[model samples]
Target: MTIRAWPSRRLGAGGLAAGALALAPVAAAEALYVPEAEPVADGVYAIIGPTDARTYENHGMNANYGIVETGEGVLLIDSGPTAFSAELIEEAVAEVTEAPIRWILNLGVQDHRWLGNDYFQREHDAEVIAFEQTVRQQQAFATDHLEGRLKEAVQDRLAGTEPAYADRRLPGEEATLALGEVRLELQRTDAHFPGDAMAYLPEEDIAFTGDLVYVDRMLGVHPWSSVQNGYEAYQELAALDPETVVPGHGRVSGMDRVERDTGAYYEFLVHEVGAAAEDLAPLQEVVERHREEPAFQHLEHYEGWHATNVNRAYLEFQQ
Candidate 1:
């Protein structure tokens, strides 16, 4: 597949400056794009991309959706980006749990969190949970980015199957659930994306980190994201010390792979960006230069995202 870069159009000086000024606001737009959902753990599950959410904007990327089993029933973390994908997850959950989907925790406020509520509410009557900031991000995404894309995504979800949605609202910093002998913990971390959260199963030594950890793919950054937050988030991952780390996308890997790969990407970002900044290279040029780095060589169809990540890194370094 041909990879595409994040679109950024520059106007004349006057317009260019205005557009540049608007970068932060535009970057803040919260769009949820997820693809097909999949089963990750024995009782855990995930969906990779284009699920009921816009996938074209972020270089056709998708957020990962996860499901954890609980004693009461099942707890879903971050619904796919649309109603149809949510329906698929619901089906998957049903296979594992006869009880109703009791709690739905949105790891963050992106469309991946709230867009599929209609399905859960209508079908299984699942109650959605999210951080207060996550709710705000969802509102921002709905108002700023979800209009056209959301409609298309929702329609796409409804195309081949019955329509669905869920009931949703904001949640607290930490929430716990019991599923037989397993205990699931949903904890918030201020990294990667703002208001990001993780699902931890201490018993399994497995952690579901949304976009916070990318196994082999390059991480995304925006003008609104804090470089420190990204760094600190990595540190948090180091602290969790999970045996298995399931990223928002890509294959599941050990904690060592998670730490090494994530750290390598960040280190590459800092080093490369520093060099580019020292020479005062433009973002586009910097992106082109590192398009073939060894660290990113194995990513499937990654050129488009590599350029975008480079641009993001340049922007982060500038700040």
Candidate 2:
């Protein structure tokens, strides 16, 4: 993970923009679960959550979120899991800067990424932005997301989270957003979910590759993910030549980590597993052949997810 020098001049409550629209204080019990924000670049912060599966202990905060200072106000990349998590994220940002969250771009359709939109929009009057595809997917999968693993893990913590869609929708495959001095180029691709997207800071050379890049953890090839498309999307991200990468789920890192974990792993799957499937290799043989692959064994959840990834890739290429 890449760490940078912290910015000086921390702001107090009076520094909040929008007439000091700071959220009410969190209860003492929820204070303990707030994730701390770490500076990754000038006026950019990342709240690195746990790399484990969602559970009661972690309160479904297993995905990372980003805080970017846009000079005028703050821009949040991904909102947290629930209303409480959003409050916690708000408090964490308050510790770093007094700027209120003015704009939010949900990078994907995952439950944790946009579920907090309701709170931010209602409280801070921030404009929630997402791709048109993301909002469609969010509407389509709201129930399953609420009742699936998230509910099973977080239980009561899932309360108060509403299905709030984006207030502003960016259509098409690409768009550019300029907030104050910060400019972000948004690109949507079929990588992790129905509407997987990434935000790039051209001037800073920072890329917030949400789910398109994972560091210190193995990327999952879900039933909907396309290995071929994922690799192609990775190539597009690499072409940008970003100096820093804030992945969807892990610590802030450089392009090398993104290449090693996500790009190379996807390349391996498409070439090796795709070849095995083309050769009519049996499923067991394919799984066994790549079970001990050394390249990504050091990543968390490798043991649990690698085989499943191989299996999914093989199935994908078999057709």
Candidate 3:
């Protein structure tokens, strides 16, 4: 699952350039299929998946979930996109270990994080844990956005199913949960979202970074006013030295690869967007010009989201 960082400009070569343009719309309609969980280290597993449908104002990439097996119980990281996928994850975990799933540490409050809460809670009595900010986002999603465009995109897959929201929250910089010999560390970060968090299993040298580190893709900018903190959030994640890095989306990779590739994407965004800002260019032109950047090149299939990311970066640049 190692992702090498290539120059964004090189994506123009071969059929990638034309293919990106052709597949943009088709990619948005497709839901990322869940991948089987694979062991990254002893007792630490990565739940990898394909690129999710691009619909939201943000959330351009799919997410990867993590699971840690310990003597006491199992610690599950971010839930998949829907309740159906979440249940599958639960069944998969059960196959390997009978220990109850004690804690579900949500890295953020997006659908990928909390929608699966009901499934885990009802079946394993697992506690849904997340940053306080994450809880707030969860409420916002439920009351405001979850049932709208978000639901419409995956309604077929969720047919006749409802997701349960969590009732509890974790607050501040750090929290630790002891699952047998493994200590799961949840560290708060402000990268992809206000409540963004990362989970680390020290004994296994694995860290599950929610959307904070988007591997092999463009980093999503926050849409809120005066917020360009996503880049800073990436720095915070780099500070946590882990051997294996499981991202919110894309393949799991070595810590070095995660840091290098994610950092490169951030730096590229800053440079490309900053240049556009300096020229006082419109958001669309900026996105159009940089469509060839490696971070965004493969995402030609997700052009619908380009406007959203561009708007976010444009606002941040102005502030």
Candidate 4:
């Protein structure tokens, strides 16, 4: 719970500067964190966040969350970035339905997805849920996430944000959650993060793909990322053929967009990079050969991230 005074990385332009600027003055920060509930179906809403990088201006609201009106109460898929952002999410949900938030699902261990759980649990006593592996991952990275880049970007906006692990952890790869008359089928995937998940609404035929898919922005392949596993997960989710997909980032889209943006992208990285690694191709050659990929060049941050993604995938495959 200690807000480490980590040195600001970006100094003048957008960095949380040393003194008072680090605080980001909640009023100004809140302005950019406003959650606009976009309706995906009757009573189901996607609170899409910014596709840009996390910064003080955006309050780290860089991941998408969901609000589902289950007749009896509301079911939230992935909480926002901070306590205040959670409040903003609540306000946005109020515009759509008057129901109180009953359940909050942490689709992945990502900070934005679950860091706001403490706020909702304290305020509305919402039950937080995630897969057991996800809870472990959250427990592992909670400190780093809270006190790491999130604090650097949003600074004091992350105040009062505590790591509230999921109260309910489901076992194995998948399970079905029945809330009132609504049923959300949750499946665990190993795509963007360890224990990332995607939810399918059988009634609505809509898929809430946690971090398994990124529709617009280029995905970051970290040391923990597995291109092989990610593509496999994408293939499985694609097989389900969910009519509509609420990607972890970007707009609410369909399977075609998911295939083009995430499925094909992951597949390309794994196949190309995997083949190169097996042949002992140099990392630079791999990076150079795939840097200007036409299919994904249009995505936000593609130029900046594509090479690093290729490098990471090459290293992962090499191992």
Candidate 1 structure quality by residue, lDDT tens digits, 18-83: 445466565544443323345567777665553222443432235566667665677777765555
Instruction: Give stretches of model 1 more than 4 Å off.
Output: 1-42, 47-62, 148-182, 190-192, 274-285
- Write the number of the candidate with greater TM-score, choosing between 1 and 4: 4
Any runs in candidate 4 off by more than 4 Å, and if so which?
1-31
Question: Model 4, residue 316: displacement in angstroms?
Answer: 1.3
Error of 3 at 283 (Å): 5.3
Q: For residues 203-300, could you state the per-residue lDDT of candidate 3 as single tens digits?
A: 77777888777666545564631234556666666676777788877678876667665666566656677657766898777867775554445542
Residue 90 local lDDT, model 3: 73
lDDT of 2 by residue, 37-110 (tens): 89988899888888888877667888888899998999998887787678778878888999989998899977
Runs off by more than 4 Å, candidate 2: 1-32
Instruction: Report the poorest 10 consecutive residues by lDDT, candidate 2.
Output: 1-10
Each candidate's lDDT (Cα)? Answer: 0.61, 0.84, 0.64, 0.84
How much lDDT does candidate 1 score? 0.61
Which residue pairs of candidate 3 clash?
Answer: 8-294, 24-301, 63-248, 64-248
Please provide, for model 4 over 141-208, each residue's C-alpha lDDT reduced to its tens digit, 9 standing for 90 to 100.
88889888999998878887888888899999999999877998998886778888889998999999
Separate clash counts for every candidate: 27, 0, 4, 0
Question: What TM-score goes with each of the models?
Answer: 0.71, 0.89, 0.76, 0.90
Output the number of the TM-score-best candidate.
Answer: 4
